[model samples]
Target: MDDAYDELLLRGRVYGADHEDPGPRPGRAYRELVGGPLDGLLLDVTGWDAEALATGAALSTHLGRHGGEGRSHYEPRPTDPRRWDWTADTP
Candidate 1:
């Protein structure tokens, strides 16, 4: 499981699951690195204080990373985060 996903859950920030369709990804995966695990990160900071959210919402080429699947007691999780990112992000 990706640490980012766990961190999101720990803070109760994740809102819902949005999985990528199955397919081959060209170049770098937008949500996850090529073949990276996680359908993609979907953490919402809408409940967070303005300061906290703004700090993480910076504009940068290195902003996107891998995450999406949950690994809690009943959360939907993939076998690996590295491979999960390989799936298509959209249909």
Candidate 2:
């Protein structure tokens, strides 16, 4: 066992087995998704520009609002730059 192994165990303890592991995202930028089917998930926007960030994105998720796979739309909140508000869902 080495430092990587120790980090793996630490990640499991921090995020649990079911939750997504949001470990050190070096050089990667992300925004917290709020509401909709993808709540509590981080949306990676590493290479997005200001225009792209403003336009938002449609994220695919297996947990649809009506109970099937669908796409969730999210837009950056006017008040918060680090969070995206879930606006709608389509199955």
Candidate 3:
């Protein structure tokens, strides 16, 4: 998995699962990149829930990289979704 994606998963483990229909959280970072103020914007997940988006954005910002700049670098190698263990039988 990409480093950033791994990092996100780690954060998710530490934080929590993303809420369904993340909404404007992803778009907020996109807008910042579109405005050209974000020279190194990276979007790890093109589509993510609000919680995931918020967590990613906060981490990226603190790391001093634009939220969009790391998208391509990390998204291609997504963490094994199965690792999340969200199965119907799990409950």
C-alpha local distance difference test of each model: 0.30, 0.68, 0.30
lDDT of each residue in 1-91, candidate 3, tens digit only: 4677444433331211245533234232231121122232333344677555433332222222334332211211134321221111100
Per lDDT, what order, best first?
2, 1, 3
RMSD of 3: 15.9
State the TM-score for model 1.
0.21
Candidate 1: stretches off by over 4 Å: 1-39, 57-91
**Poorest 10 consecutive residues by lDDT, candidate 2:** 8-17
Q: Write the per-residue lDDT of candidate 2 for residues 26-84, one digit (tens) a residue.
A: 46566667788777666667789999899888877667674546788899999976678
lDDT of 1 by residue, 1-91 (tens): 4687444444331223333433322332222222222223433333556444323322112222412332211121245422112323221
> What's the lDDT for residue 13 in model 1?
16
> Which should have the higher TM-score, number 1 or number 2?
2
Runs off by more than 4 Å, candidate 2: 1-24, 66-69
Candidate closest to the true structure, highest lDDT = 2
**Estimated TM-score for each candidate:** 0.21, 0.69, 0.19
What's the C-alpha lDDT at position 29 in model 3? 22
